[model samples]
Target: MNIVLFEPEIPYNTGNIGRTCVATNTKLHLIEPLGFSLDQKEIKRAGLDYWPKLNYEVYKSFDDFMEKNNHPKVWMATTKAHKVYSDVTYGSDDYIMFGPESRGIPEEILVDHEEECVRIPMFEDTRSINLCNSAAIVLFEALRQNHFEGLNLSGELHKLHWND
Candidate 1:
């Protein structure tokens, strides 16, 4: 799976997303004009020791990203969509894109790909969910639909065994 961030402005969110991507073995694509430098301490601090292992690339633009990645199968997450994310069948290599913290993916782009857009169900009064949380929610659903391939499904306690 892949996670693409369009013009991400928050380093902490990006950092935390990066850590999640690393843990999930997912690739991350970042579009440029980023609000914070990749070298920022905040990003590193949030990513902790996992940033080094993260597979990520920065793109000059969305067009550059599409052209370079050969136009991957992407699902855009936005508040303006009819379908729920889990309704769509996700391939293992599918890309899930989220927009900037403040604005979100451009309306023009969303209009062009309306069929591929998805939204989490939320109350009409609220604005939107947090970026990192939304990503995890949709991603985990995708992972679950695919039976969480190559991921650990269980764990052991440090000093106790469940079978004891």
Candidate 2:
């Protein structure tokens, strides 16, 4: 799975997302004009030991990203979408894009790709979910649909054997 953050602001959030990407073996794309530098201590701290293992790229602009990535299919994550995220059939190379923390993806962009926009179901009174959490929810669902390709299905206990 590929997770794209456009103009991400918070280093902590990006770091956490980076860790998640590493755990899932997913690629992460970060658009430029980021609020924090990748070298910031907060990023390494939040990403923990997994920071170095994260597979990610930084793009100069949206057009640069689109061109370099060959205009791959992208699913926009937004609160304004009428489509439920789980309803879409995600391909292995599809990208899930999230907007800046302050405001979401530009309304114009969402309008242009309205069909590709999707949203997570939430309480009517609630405003939104945390960026990191939202990304995890949709990403895991996509992974689940693909039967968690390239992922460890189960784990073993540290002090005891599974057969024990």
Query: Each prediction's Cα lDDT score?
Result: 0.94, 0.94
List, in order, the clash count of every candidate structure.
0, 0
Per-residue lDDT of candidate 2, residues 60-155 (tens digit):
998899999999899999999999999999988789999998897899889988999999999988778999999999999889988899999999
Maximum-TM-score candidate: 1
Candidate 2 segments exceeding 4 Å error: 158-164
Model 1, span 50-100: residue lDDT tens: 999999999999999999999988999999999998899998889999999
Instruction: Give the clashing residue pairs of candidate 2, or none.
Output: none
What value does the lDDT take at residue 79 in candidate 2? 96
After the best TM-score superposition of candidate 2, give how far the Cα of residue 163 lies from its true spot, in angstroms.
19
Candidate 1 whole-model C-alpha lDDT, 0 to 1: 0.94
